[model samples]
Target: MVFLKVAPMKGVMRFGKKGKLSLRFVGPFEILEKIGDLAYQVALPPALSGVHNVFHVSMLRKYILNISHILNYESLDLREDLTYEESPIKILEKPDKELKKKKITLVKVLGRSHAVKVAIWEHEDEMRAK
Candidate 1:
C-alpha cells in the first residue's frame, strides 16, 4: 500500500554474484509521476534489471511477485494508489565500464531494506554463469 507520508525504506540488490548488474532507488517515495496504469519514477529498489538478464526460476518469480504486490496494494493515504511499471521477467546484462574495471561483471542494488529487495538478488553466479 502507498503511504501518504513517505515511509522510511532502503537497500541494495545485485542480479549477479559479481555485482555487475544493478539498479538503486532511495525511497521516501513521493509519487513522482502517475499515468493511467503505469507509475513512472515511483520509488523502487536500487539495481532493478531492465529486461535482458537471464534469471533462475525461483528468483524470477520472486522479483515479479514483489513488484506486483507493491503495485497492487492500495495506498494508505490516497484513495486508490498502486505503483509499478512492469514485471522483471527479462533481465538484460549491460556492460558497465566501471564494473569491468574492477574485474567484476556484476550488478548491485543498495539501500536500506533487505526483505523488500531480496528478490532482486536471485540470479547468482553459480546459477547464472552457465
Candidate 2:
C-alpha cells in the first residue's frame, strides 16, 4: 500500500470581501482552472507549510507595485493576466542544507511579458518573529 502525504491548507481569501481581488498560480492553471468571476485553485508548495490564508488584493498589489522592478519594462501597455505565488509559512527554524538550497524565492510572473523582472532578497531577522 502506498500512502501519499497530504498538505494542510486553509481559506486564504474569499469573495465579497474588502481588499479582495483575483490571482492565479503561474503553473497549475490547467488543473486549477478559473471560471471567470468565479475562483482559481492554488497549490501551495512545501515552503508554504503552516500558512493559513492570504489577502488576494495584497498579493496582487505586491506584484503590480513591483512590476517596474520585476519586468524591467517601461510601458504597462502589456496588461497580461498573470499569477504570483509566495509561501505564507515561516522557515529558518531548522537550517538544513537542502532547505537552505531550496530557500524561499520571491517570484513574479507577468503574462506575455518576457521582460518581466523577478527579484529575491534575504529577509531581515526582525522580519521573522521569534
Candidate 3:
C-alpha cells in the first residue's frame, strides 16, 4: 500500500480555494504493478476513476501497517430530516450580555445533540419558548 502525492502542474486545477491549501497525499492505494523504471500503477477508488492511476516512485510513500487505520463506524438513528432530536438535560450557566440598549440573557444548555454531547449557549427567552 502507498500514498500518492497530489500536486499542481501545468494545465492543472487545484483542489482548494485561493491561498496555501493543505491538500497533500491522497491515498493508501494498493500497487498493482511497476509500469516502468519509476512509475507504479495504483488502484484508485471509483471516485477517482477519471484520474490517472500511474504515479512516479518519488510521489509514492510506503504505508506502515497501523491498527488505527481500521474504522469503527456506528450507525446513527436519524429521522426523516437526517437529524435526531436532542433535549436539554440541564442548564449549566446563565450569563447577561450588556447591549447598548438592554441586557441580553444567555443560557448554557447541556444536551446530547451530537455523538459527543456538548454544551451550547442559547438565548434565555428562546429556551423558555421551546
Candidate 4:
C-alpha cells in the first residue's frame, strides 16, 4: 500500500469548501507496475479516472497497515465526489491594513487540524457580510 502526496492548495480545494485539513494523504492504493526508475503506475479508483494513474516516486509513501493499530486509527470517509467536509475551528489573529481609502481586515483562521502550519486568511468584512 502506498499513499499519494497531493499539493496542499489543490488538496484543500478538492476536499471541500472548508477543506479536510488533516487529510493530506488520500490513499493506500496498489501499485500496478513500475513505469520507470522514478515513477510507477498505480491503480486509481473510478472517481479519479480523469487523473493519470502514473506518479513519481516522490509523490508516493509506503503505508504499513497493522490490524491492531488500525483499530485506533481513524480513516477519512471519502465521499463519492472524493471530498470530505471540515470547518475552521477559530480565528487566531485579526489584523487591519489601510489601503488608500479602504481598510482591509484580515483574519487568520485555525483549521480543524493542528498540523496545519499555514493559517488560512480571509477578509473579515467579506466573511462577516456573507
Query: Considering every candidate listed, which one attains the maximal TM-score?
Result: 3
The top-ranked prediction according to lDDT is 3
Global lDDT of each model?
0.33, 0.33, 0.83, 0.77
Tens-digit lDDT track for model 2 on 1-130?
1111222235555222222342332211112333345333344456555653222322321122333434444444433565433323333333323364566433222123334443333333423431
- lDDT by residue for model 3 over 1-130, one digit each (tens)? 9988887465545555333554567778999999989999999999889989898999999998898777665456889988876778899999999999999999999976554468999999999998
TM-score ranking from best to worst? 3, 4, 2, 1
Question: What residue pairs clash in candidate 4, if any at all?
Answer: none
TM-score of each: 0.17, 0.18, 0.55, 0.47
Ranking 1 against 4 by TM-score, winner: 4
Worst 10 residues of 2 by lDDT: 22-31
Question: Against the true structure, candidate 3 has what lDDT?
Answer: 0.83
lDDT of 4 by residue, 63-102 (tens): 8987754434345666899876545677899989889898
> For model 4, what is the error of residue 40's alpha carbon versus the real structure, in angstroms, after optimal superposition?
0.5
Clashing pairs in 2: 12-53, 70-117, 71-116, 71-117
Q: What order do you get sorting by lDDT, best first?
A: 3, 4, 1, 2
Of 1 and 3, the candidate ranking higher by TM-score:
3
Off by over 4 Å in 4: 10-12, 17-22, 69-130
